[model samples]
Target: MSNISIIGLGGVARAIGARAIEGGNAVEVIGRDAAKAKDLAAALGGGATAGTFGATPVGDLVVLAVPYAGAVPVIAQYGDALAGKVVIDVSNTSNADATGLVTPDGTSGAQEIAKAVPASAHVVKAFNTVFGHILAQGGPLDVLFAGDDARAKASVSAFIESLGLRPLDAGGLEVARWLEGTGLLMISLARHGVGNFNFSLGVDLPG
Candidate 1:
């Protein structure tokens, strides 16, 4: 990936942006609060930027790091500008489970993002479950990514690998629903004290 645009300057975006900068990619960070974006960009120190969501330049890949509800409106604002771009959905739907905790649902934030963006946009689901605290370590984790477009999926997989994270292709756009749900189900673990946000999904198939 040559350039990466991160939409949202939250903790998640910050972690991912820092990793992107470390990888030598020119990063543009867009957020509602200009001060926060500038602060983050300054910290990144590798051609990072602060701007409105619409001002984000066209890049090899774009990462949506905002809440679920925020994704649709941002897509609308971008319009045709997002055509042919690879979009990664790294947000959860904020739902919970049987115990008053975030429940993972069948339809996820990724699916919703695909619907919101133009058909020309290759939207991939990823980064939703990784916590900011763990992400900053620049270590690898079992990351599940879903997209209908093979080229786009491959591109995102490469970016994930750059962060030292393992990539798992979860089939197509629909698989995003399950991935989103998994993130929500994780919330229950934290609520019940069975696990904190540190809970992560790891797959170890019998070889």
Candidate 2:
């Protein structure tokens, strides 16, 4: 089982922590509000614990479950504490209205976050496409991910599998921009095409 440190206290973070714990992975919940972190850890149970904010997380895999805007700043706060760890960026760069991406034409939120993290840490973009409630339900859903480091991607893929999901590698860090776009598209489809958020994006290979 993997040791995971989730760096947020929001719904997404809670859902991931729950699934990670259910998957038999040890979890450490970290947040600016220590009380909320403790509360979330207690809620998740299964040996999940609260981690001190801005401190070096005890887990090898760190999930950055914060908003896109706060991702880089949060990484900056962690500094070298995250060195040599596999950092997962589960944020989308969509604007406030979800109509467009907030990042520039060439970069993604994951890419920007990579810039802020220590050189020893590897950033992998993932989980931005799935809704928190749907993910919390626990199903064999498809999780698309992108990163530059092969070993880091493999580790993240294994973690995804442990959570009872399929992991599709969508190439390197450059592909993260398109993944963010796909996340915005999912939002658009949910509001206009699908008319609801009950669905998830996936692939069906020919057998």
Candidate 3:
């Protein structure tokens, strides 16, 4: 069983943790609010535990499932406790209010997260482009992400595959600029009421 610690208790975190437990992984759901953490953990069931900020530093995969602005602070909060662990950044850095990417001069959200955490930890971008609704509903869902570390990427890809989803390796963390932007586009498309295009797409290759 994989030791998974999700560093947020929200819709996205719930969706991901639920799926991970279904895949036979041990999941610890964390939150600043302890009561909320217990509620969320109870919802997850089967040996899943609710965690406070003081929980043990024991996840094989640490999922950063908070907002874009909270990424670095979360890393700082975890501090030396997370050294040598793999971080799965599922936070989208796009400004939902402004409907645009929020990082500095062409830097992507996950890339920013990588900068914040200690070098001892490996960071991989995953599950940011997809909405929480689709993940909970279980689609032929598509998870798009990038990372500099090959082993880190492989580990996250395995988790995604275990959930019966497609993992699209969009190259190095530099590609996060595009990945982050796509979240805005996805919301716009859904708001525009283009049913078929809402959270779904296809690509054609010329022979």
Candidate 4:
């Protein structure tokens, strides 16, 4: 079991923490609000703990479950503390209206986050495609991820499998831009065509 540190106490963070705990991984929750983090950890149970916001994470894998804007500051604040660790970027660069990516065409949220961290810190983009509600269900769903680090991707893939979810590698860290686009597309579909939030984007293989 892996020790996972989640850097938020919001819905996404809570969902990931709950699933990690269910998969028998040690969970440490950190957020700007210490009381909220402690409360979330208490609610999660399963021996989960609350961690300091700016401290080095106790887990081998640290998930940045906060919004895209929030993630950048967290990465900067953590700095060398995240060295030699797998930092999972679950943030998307979508605008508030879900119209387009907030980041420029050549860069992505994950790639930018990677640039802010130490060299030894492996940044992998995962879990940005799925919504919090779908993740909480702990179900058979596809999770697309991208990163330059193979080992980090493999570790994330293993963790996804442990949660009974399928992990699909979408090339290197540059592909994270596409993943964020997929997130925007999914949101647009949900708002217009799909007309509901009970669905997820997935790939279909030939029979």
Candidate 5:
């Protein structure tokens, strides 16, 4: 099992921390509010612990569970602390109404975040397509991920599997834009086509 450090105190952070702990990975919860981070870590149990905000994470795999707007700022704050770490960007760069992406025309939120991190650090886009509650509920969910580094993707794939989920690589980091678009599509589906938020986007294979 991989040592995991999750940045955020939201539903997404809670879900990932819980699953990571359940998978026997060491979990460290980090947030701006130290008390809340401790509370969340305590709540998670299973040897979960709280980490100092803006500090070098104790885990090789760092999960950035913050919203898209906060992603870059948080990375900036962490600075060189994230060097050599496989950073997982789990944020969606969608507008408030979920009408479209907030990222620039060509680049994605993940790609933009990648630019902010250290040269040695790798950014892998993932978990943006899944709802926190559904993930918390636990099941064999398909997690689509994109990253430029093969080694980083492999590490993330193993981490996803540790959470009882399947990891599907959606090509290089350049593909993150499409993944973000897919995230927006999921929201639109929930509000219009699907009429609810309890469902997840997935694939069906011909067996």
Candidate 6:
């Protein structure tokens, strides 16, 4: 089992925490508010513990469950603590109204995070296309991820499979830009005739 540290206490964090526990991985919840982190840990009730924010995370894999804007600051605060660890970026860098991406062309939130962290830190982008409600409901979903580090992507892919979900490798870190755009597209589709946030983006592969 993998040691997973999720940095945030929002619905996404909580949902991922629950799934991690169910996957038999040790989970640590870290947040800006100590009380909220502890409460979430207790609510998870699967040997999950509350960890201090800006401290070295206990998990080998750290999931940034915060918004796109908050990710860089968190990475800076973690600093060298994240070195040699796989940091998963789950933030979607989109406009305020979700009409388009906020990041400039040829750049992505994961790529920016990768540049901000220490050299040894392996940054991988995943779960941006999936919603919290879908995860909480325990459905089988395809989690698309991209990273320049092969070992790091393998580690994350193993964790994804542990949760009974499919892991789709969308190529190297450069692909994160398209992954973020896919998130925006999902949002747009949900708001239109899809009419719900319960769906997830996936491929219909041949059997």
lDDT of each: 0.79, 0.94, 0.81, 0.91, 0.95, 0.94
lDDT of 2: 0.94
lDDT of 2 by residue, 31-149 (tens): 99999999999999999999999999999999999998888889999999999999999998999999999999999999999999999999999999898889998888999999999
Error of 6 at 161 (Å): 0.8
The local lDDT score (0 to 100) that residue 119 gets in candidate 1 is 79
Candidate 6's residue-wise lDDT over 1-207, tens digit each? 799999999999999999999999999999999999999999998899999998999999999999999899999988999988899999999899999998999999999999999998999999999988898899699999999999999999999998888999999999999999999999999999699887888989998
Candidate 3 C-alpha error for residue 178, in Å: 1.1
Candidate 2 wrong stretches, greater than 4 Å:
none
TM-score of model 5 (CA atoms): 0.99
Candidate 2 colliding pairs:
none
lDDT of 1 at 124: 94
Worst 10 residues of 4 by lDDT: 157-166
Q: What stretches of model 3 exceed 4 Å from their correct place? A: 54-56, 193-198, 201-207
Better by TM-score, candidate 3 or 1 = 3
TM-score of 6: 0.98
TM-score order, best first, reads 5, 2, 6, 4, 3, 1
Tens digits of per-residue lDDT for model 1 on 1-207?
557888888889989988888877778888878888899889888888876768635577999888776788988888877887899988877643333223235556676677777778889999876767778776668888899999999999888877778889989988877777677666777767665676566678797
Q: Residue 47 of model 4: what lDDT?
A: 99
What's model 5's lDDT at 86?
96
**Clashes in model 4: which pairs?**
none
TM-score of every candidate: 0.88, 0.99, 0.91, 0.97, 0.99, 0.98
| Candidate 5 lDDT, 1-207, residue by residue in tens | 999999999999999999999999999999999999999999999999999999999999999999999999999999999999999999999998899999989999999999999999999999999998999999899999999999999999999999999999999999999999999999899989899999987887999
Off by over 4 Å in 1: 96-106, 205-207
Candidate 1 deviation (Cα RMSD): 2.6
Q: Write the per-residue lDDT of candidate 4 for residues 1-207, one digit (tens) a residue.
A: 788999998899999999989989999999999999999999999999999988999999999998998888889988889989999999888998899999988999999999998999989999989999989987788999988988888999998887778899999999999999999998999999989988987889999
The residue ranges of model 4 lying beyond 4 angstroms of the native Cα positions read none
Please tell me which model should have the higher TM-score, number 3 or number 5: 5
- In Å, residue 26's CA in model 1 sits off its true spot by 2.0
